[model samples]
Target: MDTGKKVGDLFGRLGKVPGRGVGIGLQLLVGAGGLAYGVSQSMYTVEGGHRAIIFSRLGGVQNEVYAEGLHFRIPWFHYPIIYDIRSRPRSISSPTGSKDLQMVNISLRVLARPDAVALPRIYRQLGTDYDERVLPSICNEVLKSVVAKFNASQLITQRSQVSLLVRKELTERARDFNIILDDVAITELSFGKEYTAAVESKQVAQQEAQRAQFLVEKAKQERQQKIVQAEGEAQAALLLGDAVTKNPGYLKLRKIRAAQSIARTIAQSNNRAYLDANTLMLNLTDLGYDQGATRAGTSKK
Candidate 1:
């Protein structure tokens, strides 16, 4: 019985040893809280579509631009400032018009992407407010400067060219801001009321001139048709005259047919011969000559 009791005591002490060790280990871990937190701060994640810059009191730290995914740094000595590396667009409305100075309304759409390789230089020089500071300043400066070169009418008409100029100038200036300008476009352009009205009137006049030209062409076509018809009739008459010369009997036959047609029209009832008074007198003279010749021949016998 005593031996069993001793064995139980030994096992109890052995269990206590593990508990004491675990307690000491926990206490040591608790005491190093600051160190653990510092270590944790050294590691972070730069999510997709974002790039991080490590900033320190030391000017222009060599290591910069943490790409997407987990990254590590020295705790408390370095901090990461994240910037969206995705493409983004910014726009502004045009300045209103003035009397002494005519103004044109212009709206611009600009595409920009962060310079991933130049993040350290950008954060050092341009700082965190890249959109508010760098983008707007470049856009406004380039827009106003390029716009000053053209009149209001020309600005509205040649907006595409103006946009190209803005893109070129801004692209050149963007090197300093550590951004790449992908595209720049002037999406909208407008003019004052009077200028719009004048343009409308000019369009109306152009349409009217086109309509008048169409009418003139139609009249010329009608005149040409009349001339062609007259020429065809003359050609037909010449052909008919040649046929009559080849067959002289055609005229006699035509005269007899004309007289017969007139007779047929007057004698509407068929099988009835209608003779004029001159034809009756010529038949009676031929009958009187035949009677005289017969009576003289009998007397001579």
Candidate 2:
């Protein structure tokens, strides 16, 4: 009976301990909260236009890369480093020497992005600031190399070609560092003030030469037209003289026609002559009437 009473007393004490089951539940709840916090920490969401590279504490960088979305990893051991895969623009001003040893200032724009397939390699080699580390230097080197192959005037005239060559060289070089070169443009090209002045002077001189040539051609054309007119007039006078030599009666016929034309003009005038019709007929001999009469008389005989 005494041992039973002592056991009942121990049970009563254990029951009397306030909220013992609640204490055990609270401990379990704290443990679950910690586990949930750790799981939350292990999950990450990569946003649009971004990719994540996982780094393992024990194994180093993982081959697998995470695309834009939710991803899971081991808590505290694996972390995601996000990189922007969007195309970015960079402008660089490079001063270089031309083939003619002229100082050329070139402003260029480069559109570039990291190779998505080689992002891991790029991160390993160049990190997040890959553009800053690799592109500017490569662009400068390639631009200078291309510029050295062309003269200052060529840079102005063959700007597109120069840009193409630079793009090609830059693309090849950038590929070595796992970068994609989308496009390259030469925005501006300038030379020294003296060179510009010389070019302007040359253009002005060429224009003046063209104007002078045009004036000379115009003078030649006018001289040719005058010479042709004089030749035509001389040929016409010579034809007339030959016609007169071939037929002596042609002059007498012309004189008669002129006299008849004068008679018609005098008849049409407003002023009346006081001469009689007989006087007019007598005056007709002055034209070739007498010659015609002699020819007729000889023919009849």
Candidate 3:
């Protein structure tokens, strides 16, 4: 049989054993949590449209570019530099003088992407925001140079050729800086207000000149019509005179027709008309009749 104090002391020892076990369990849990933290830090995943580059303390930048998946780097010894390798659209705009000394506004749009194989070099030189550094400078240069070669009117008329030249030169220039430009185009183009007004005035002047030319041509046609009418009337009068000279009886027939017209007019009128015997419409004596009368008078005498 144990004494009372001894029993109390034994209970105390049993309680301490359980407390030791709890402390050791807590230590194990803490160690596991630390290990998980370290593992998460050393590894990373490259998602879609993203690339990673490794930098070593001993080496500046490694050339092996990492694609999408699990990748590991030494905790604090190696650094993983991630970049988004996606096509992005960027616009650049500027005011430039054209070849004809016209002030012009121009806008250029480009689709830019970093070269996958050149990721290491790009990181070393331009870093994460490489497109920001590379695109604007070269695009400004290309726009100014290309626009300077063409007149303001040519920029509007030969716009396709201008865009082609801009695309060709910009693509080449971007390639030099480890950037790939999928497309380049002139998005906007405009000229000064004074030039626009001048063009409008020129078009108005051209229309006015065309109207004047039409009026002149119409006047010439009218003159030709009057001359033709006069020639026709003169030729008809000459033919009538020749007919009267060839046929003496034609005069008597004309006189008879005139007399019939006069009688019809006088019959239709309400007023009384007294015509003389010698009048052209009333004359009925012939030259042969007159000669016969004279011969009879002489014989009688």
- Predicted model with the maximum lDDT: 3
lDDT of each: 0.76, 0.85, 0.88
Candidate 3, residues 1-301, lDDT tens digits: the string is 4698899999999989999999999999999998998898899899999999999998879999999999998888898888888989998998999999999999999999999999999988898899889898999899999999999989999999999999999999998989998888889998889988998999999999999999999999999999999999999888866655565455567778988898898889999888776664555576764465456445544
lDDT of 2 at 172: 97
Ranking by lDDT: 3, 2, 1
10 residues in a row with least lDDT, candidate 3: 292-301
**How do the residues 1-301 of candidate 2 rate in per-residue lDDT, one tens digit apiece?**
9999999999999987878878988999999999999989989999999999999999988888789999999988999989888999999998989999998989889999998878888888889999999988998899899999999888888888888898889999999998898888899889988888998999999999999999999999999999999999999888866655565555557666776776787899999766553444434445456566556545544
Query: Which candidate has the top score in TM-score?
Result: 3
Q: Which runs of model 1 end up more than 4 angstroms from their true locations?
A: 1-26, 32-35, 57-69, 95-103, 147-163, 238-301
Q: Is candidate 2 or candidate 3 better by TM-score?
A: 3
Over 1-301, each residue of candidate 1 has an lDDT whose tens digit, in order, gives 9999999999999999999999999998987986788878989999899988886756546555678999898876777889888889888665644333566666788889878898777777777677767887777777778877887766766767877788899899987777898888888877667777877999999999999999999999999999999999999898866655565445445655666676667678666766773443323245654465455444544
**TM-scores for every predicted model:** 0.60, 0.70, 0.72
lDDT of 1: 0.76
Tell me how many residue pairs clash in candidate 3. Answer: 0
* TM-score (C-alpha, index-matched) for candidate 3: 0.72
Mark the regions of model 2 whose C-alpha exceeds 4 Å error after superposition.
Answer: 1-32, 240-301
Question: Could you give the candidate ranking by TM-score, starting with the highest?
Answer: 3, 2, 1
